[model samples]
Target: MTPRPLPTSPAPHRVVALLRPPQAPFPLACATEVFGDHGPAIPARYAFELCTEHPGPVRTGAGYDMVVTTGLEALERADTVLVPGWHQPPGTEAPPAVVAAIRAAHRGGARVVGLCSGAFLLAAAGLLDGRRAATHWARAAELATRFPQVRVDPAVLYVDHGDVATSAGSAAGVDLCLHLVSSDQGAAYAMRVARQLVMPPHREGCQLQYAELPTSGPVADSLAPLLEWLSGRLDQPVSVAEMAVRSQVSARTLTRRFSEQLGISPGRWLLDRRIAATRALLEETDLSVETIAGRVGLSSAVNLRRRFHEALRTTPAAYRRAFRAERAG
Candidate 1:
């Protein structure tokens, strides 16, 4: 028998999770389960640790104290800083030390993650300012009111800005964690993790179905082939009838399938996809609106601005400026 070579492992990604008093246990578990030990079956990919501002007993709000010995300094060496859930009253501000620590970690190049109410902490750190953030829908109004600078989109399950990420309440944390895994490792490895956790492969954040930067969730279907086709033709003119032709189905049938599976009409989905493309361009490129509009099939800057404002509540130029500032910061 031929000898087999041993598998090689990659560099460990250090994930330091922040623990404030009154932590929400479920979201903490979500982060720990995903980024913590992978057991004997899977090779270790991440180093998971916990920290607090005061570095002592932490309240779980579930009737138990979690004794954490590490302090905010733990974030100094982290590749990623995750705040699972901070259970504070609506108007309360995050501790100055904690906010400063998170801000320092982010400036030091660690990606910051906030799950559920943790978004409030990131906002206090100024990470979510001028960015589209996600949180528990119930608290969305409060978050918006408290942090007027943050663009809170409560309808989405999660929103990832590459450097900073936030998720909706509860299980949505799992989705965002899995998404981070996919982005860090690969879809195949993330799929293995999801299987270990007994979840679907992945689900597109379906609230928007086609919104800008919506996190991954269940891939809608029957329209899968059509969607794949449309992705390639985003730079060209595409109509419902043309899409039906490409899918080899009647326009009515396509519309029906979209409604049944995606909960949106075909036209709406297409427009949203274009808006999404526009947003991506605004973030990544310095392309003019006229150029971007043509690239995304909007045909003109005027039409693109109208649709972009309708979808995102911000003009293309302003969105670009805000994201540029975020990147610069």
Candidate 2:
């Protein structure tokens, strides 16, 4: 059957977020919060709507039911099509109709986006083949295992390829939506939307997931005291040798423990923590870059900028500006 032609709309853009049971509510909300009307405070740049495969009461991951009247037919009219998330049981496949509708939408010049587990559906629709995608870290391995043709980067917050995009779990979906707004309009307009939502306007898609941090338990017990001590003393110079000395283990043993417990070496873990602390200072304080560097143990603004850029793919000044704009907005 020939698909319906795209809608001729006077509205600036039409964004349709596709849902399927049991849908993930948070990602769906992320799309809506970004694209939904915010009164005159933020101009209506896009007309956002929701659609489902069967067009009835769809069960959500949160154990509630939401009635959606629109069907996959909505994809035919969308300027941008979003799949918030999909049923995530292992080895499950997207319904053929849903997959076909997504592909048809893309073919008709719609930009398609998948959030979190929704990447699986995009993969099923063959939209993600030969492209880098991002999803929740927990499901990255499964996504890769199931769709070998797709390049899945588990570390990133999101991946945007212009025609298609995918974001990591929950909050990262917000990041992706803000990115879409930025791309569609511009940084200033996107910042306005982000201000309404009380969220940071821009986070580089390449930033590593903070959720990748190690869990605490018996494995981390031996080093827990030292970890706490290090965290409180980020202003002081710290070395692996000092960490080993404090933990009463050899440097090699400390590194082994870190690898076994945290899946990273001691030095790497320390660096990550220092970087994380630096980010907090950047967001919450008005400290000069040099002062922040000294407080975070980086010693110099040049070194802090280099390490911050390496870790987040964005400069501290830019990050601070985005967050400050969010606050001012």
Candidate 3:
């Protein structure tokens, strides 16, 4: 009997993860866990590599140096190029050569990702100009000051604008990698990757990092119970008046409480939660768009699509397709 030929249509994805001097190990690990070579037991789809400005050893932030045999030349043919934190001090300029390499890769149609402070490099390279990007909160102000051309949204975990993407610091890098997995393969693939990494399958990048609201002067603990109630009822429309009644407080008092604690209006908080729930369902379930809409308390599929597109910059259908493709691959 003759041996069978391998399938030809689905090519492996090529990802080049750029490693700067004094690189942040966590973000690099996040990229590796998501895309690096795994044995046949793992059902791998990506050919991931770690590349540096020079084909030599690069220092890691963890006080050790690792050899990176690949150089910027690797990015020339990559489907995606990820910068996992620039590793430079806050407010410092990125090297022009590094910036040029990133720009050239992106210009050649490779997707560009800036995980954590890597966003600073992307912005410095002028790729993030007039685009929404994010960075570690501690460096957010500095990034904004240095690159006024880019819109800095420090709160969101990540922002994906097709060819260019950026994420917040630390663990948020995982979210962005998962997002890339989802985008390149599909939700199922992304979920499987997350499972292999032992991480949550889906988290709306826009979800607040901490559920705890900014606290003011001490007051009643009533808001805590109300929040718990809201959390459980995210699927249903939650009105400010209804929340006030449930908390046994006047509408005005409830509004003040939410503003003081959450730093956002109660209505905004409710919408945010609903959107987050929608994201989870979108990335985890095989439900229809209309069904997801109802489950997330949106008015209809139309409303969900509109709001989701506005918030995430891609339609639910497109997002689903990306994840599904990754999984299937």
Candidate 4:
């Protein structure tokens, strides 16, 4: 089918999630949350639908079944095609017809998305041959090993390269959907959706899934005070020794507590908190890098950049530019 050029005029964008048998329910639900119903508070600007290769009831890994009459043909007319996580039985491949349909839709101008392991299907279709993509960190190695041509980033939540986008596991799918909403509509609309869902307005797609410092336990009795202190002193130099002193514990004891409860060291937790603060500053303020670094306890812009890149794979400037552009556009 010949696809029409994407309309430059702003309109209600259509997002179709192409599901397969035994699909990941979370990604599908995430797609629905961000695009499904806008209710009365938010203006209706998105048209979301669930489409499958063949019309009828599709089984989900979640042990339920859903009826979806829309088929692959709907994809040809879509502005965007979302492939949520796919369930490929061990040593099995996605149906070839599905792969062909995905390629045809993309070739016809619809933006293609692969959330989580759905990326495997997109990769198999040759859509991700030379582009950077991400999957669940657990599946990254397998995807890389199988599709040597695709650059797999196990660390990022998602990667957007204009026409094609790939996301990491589970909740990252939310981030990708929100991103598409932000890109197609604007940050204001995306934020409205996020607010409706009670999630962060935006998160750096590169944010780590785990803290460097592990929690010892729900020793809110002790940790609560520490967190409060840490939050208030984001600008100060915090050390394990200082934390231990304030907590009335020895450095060794505190380290043990962090390991048993948090899974990361106290120092790492502090750094992560600082990084989170830095990200907030980057998103919410126009502060200079030097100023942001000091405010986030990073001491220097150079240090902040290095840490930010290591954690997110994008520079602070690029991150801000992308988010700001999303906000404005």
Which candidate has the highest lDDT of all?
2
Q: Provide the lowest-lDDT 10-residue window in model 3.
A: 208-217
Candidate 4 C-alpha lDDT tens digits along 249-312: 9999988887777667898888878877877788899999999999988999999999888776
For candidate 2, give the lDDT of residue 94.
Answer: 71
Q: Worst 10-residue stretch by lDDT in candidate 4? A: 208-217
Return the candidate ranking by lDDT, descending: 2, 1, 4, 3
The total of clashing pairs for model 1 equals 5
Q: What's the TM-score of each model vs. the native?
A: 0.62, 0.68, 0.62, 0.63
Give the CA lDDT, 0 to 100, for residue 303 in model 2.
96
Query: In lDDT terms, how accurate is model 2?
Result: 0.87
> Which segments of candidate 3 are over 4 A away from where they belong?
1-10, 90-92, 211-329
Q: How accurate is candidate 4 locally (lDDT)?
A: 0.83
Instruction: Report how far off residue 29 is in candidate 4 (Å).
Output: 0.5
Misplaced by over 4 Å in model 2 are 1-16, 30-50, 53-55, 69-80, 90-101, 104-110, 134-160, 167-219, 248-250
What is candidate 3's lDDT per residue for 265-310, written digit by digit as tens? Answer: 8887777777777777767999998998888888799999998766
lDDT of each residue in 1-329, candidate 2, tens digit only: 53333323256889999988888889999999999987766667899999988889998878999999999899999999998987857756678898899999999999999999989989998999999999998889889999999999988999999999999998999999999989987887788888789897788898767553333335557989988888799888989999999999999999888888877887777788888888788889999999999998999999999998877767998878877875787
